[model samples]
Target: MRIKAAVLHASPIAKPYAETRPLRIETIELDPPGADEVLVKIAAAGLCHSDLSVINGDRPRQIPMVLGHEASAVVVETGAGVTDLVPGDHVVMSFLPTCGHCLPCAEGRAQLCAPGAAANGAGLLLSGAQRLHCDDGTDAYHHCGVSAFAEYAVISRRSMVKIDRDFPLVEAALFGCAVMTGVGTIVNTCGVRPGQSVAVVGLGGVGLSSVLGAVAAGAERVIALDLSRAKLDLALSLGATDAFLASDPDVVEAVRAATSGGVDHAVEMAGSAPAFELAYKITRRGGTTATAGLANPNARISLAPVHLVGEERVIRGSYMGSCVPARDIPRYIALNQRGRLPVEKLLSGTGPLDEINAAFDLLDQGKVVRHVITF
Candidate 1:
């Protein structure tokens, strides 16, 4: 079948993407689902910083790719031997596909499944086949095994989680990446208790989502830090107890003093080395600073060796919030339904697929939280 998708020809493109317009919307051919895959019609997809990373060259990918990993879709067809889902089932696309037999998957950490990573690195399905062919007869890679920027996609069953049929697809799209990474980092990776003081650095979609997670987790105080005032203000409206400007020279000190020492937990979501540095410096002794940011692989942070031993400070890296999609997605959604995690508040607005370039511009300026592309 033929469908429309935002296709990025190559990664590491020249900056000022607005002028270059790297992601070109094109109509292409998408094959049917394989035996281990499912065909989905996308309803909404979120514009995440990770996707921006690829466009700006911060993250590298096999190019000529359909560039979206966070999205919600309805099952249009299921491949042979598939029993868990049928047509019309609403689902969120998980960027990582779990090959249940892999070491990470067997250990209940499907996000790190080796086979999934391999598949993602190669821009192919778990079976190592490319399903999309461009008009020029070139193979288009699947971004992170999802490639959900397209109107339709064929994904491994491992890449999808069936959701309540009535759940709004726009909101469910966030759960695919931003919500899972941010909220899961606080709830699952850190095990934040009700009285713990927490700080979330950066105010992108993932960072703001962490703000909601901390509030819902009953934190004594939630300090929102960002370089943007607009985001801080939005965070305040969404239950943040305090807000700080990351650009302030005294920001780290302010966070520490406000918490009477330092926050028990600090989350770095800005995907920058500087943001991670701030998160680390503001953590109280014996506290944990969890980093979920996908910084450029070459970027490095300065960590004092003595602090690790003397202060017993835990500087842990959180990938996919150490989540088991089959378990955490439903749990988070239940909380959202109960009004404890109103992630919808993070939606800045929606745009059409053709306007994705403009949406990326807004996102690059730190002007929007979650920009949804409504199909």
Candidate 2:
């Protein structure tokens, strides 16, 4: 079938995406879902930094690829050997497509599945094939096994997490990435307990979501840190007890003073070396510093070797917030439905695929959070 989709060609494109226009919308061909795959007619998809990373050449990938991973869709058709889902079932797409039999999947750490990583890097489904092709006969690699920046997507079953039919698709799209990564880091990765002091170092969608997660988990104090005052205000509205600008040289000290000697847990979602360092510095003794940000592949953080032993500070990396989509997506969806996880506040607005280039500009400037492309 022919579908209108956004395709990213050569990277290192200039900014103001509207001018350079790295991601171009074009008519493309979509193959039928192969075995263990399903055809998802995308309802809504979010514009994540990860996608921008490709266009800006921060995270390079095979050229001529469809770019989009966070999305909500309806199962238009199921391929052979697919029994658990059928036509019309609403679902959210997981960027990682777990083969279920990989070593990581067997250990309940599907987020680290090697096969998924390889396929994502190569821009193909777990089956290792391109289901999308440009009009010029070039095969556009799939992005994170989803390639949801289009009208229709052929994705693997492992990437689909079925959700309630009544759930709002636009909001459901955020669960695919931001919510899962943010909230999951708190509840799953760090297991933040009630009355604990937590700091979220970044005010993007994921960081903001972490603020809500900390509050919902009963954190005694939630410190929201960011360079944008606008984002800080939003964080305060979303339950952050205090807000600080990361640009402040004494920001870490301020956070520590607010939490009576640093927070018990600091989640770094800014995806920068400085952000990671700040998170580590503001963590209380024996506190955990968890990072889910996708910093530059070449970026490095400096840690005090002695502090590791003296302070007993723990540092860990969180991919997809250490989330198991099947187990966590439903739980989060329920939370959002009940008004506990107000993810609705995270969405800035929506646009058609044509305006996606402009949306990328806003995303680049951190002018919006969770901008969804409505199909």
Worst 10 residues of 1 by lDDT: 10-19
TM-score of 1: 0.98
lDDT per residue for candidate 2 within 1-375, as digits (tens), equals 999999998898997889888888899999999999999899999999899988888899998989999999999999998999989999999999988888999999989988998999888899998899888888889999999999999999999899999999999999999999999999989899999999999888899989989988999999999999999999999999899999998887888888889999999999899999999999999999999999999998888889989999899889998999999999998888889999999999999999999999999899998899999
- Candidate with maximal lDDT: 2
The 10-residue segment of model 2 with minimum total lDDT is 251-260
For residue 43, model 2's alpha carbon misses the true position, in angstroms, by: 0.3
lDDT of 2 at 289: 97
Q: Provide the clashing-pair count of each candidate structure.
A: 0, 0
Cα displacement (Å) at residue 25, model 2 = 0.9
For candidate 2, the TM-score is: 0.99
lDDT of 1 by residue, 161-272 (tens): 9999988999999999999999999998999999999999998989988999999999989999999998899999989999999999999788888898899999999999
Output the lDDT of residue 336, model 1.
95
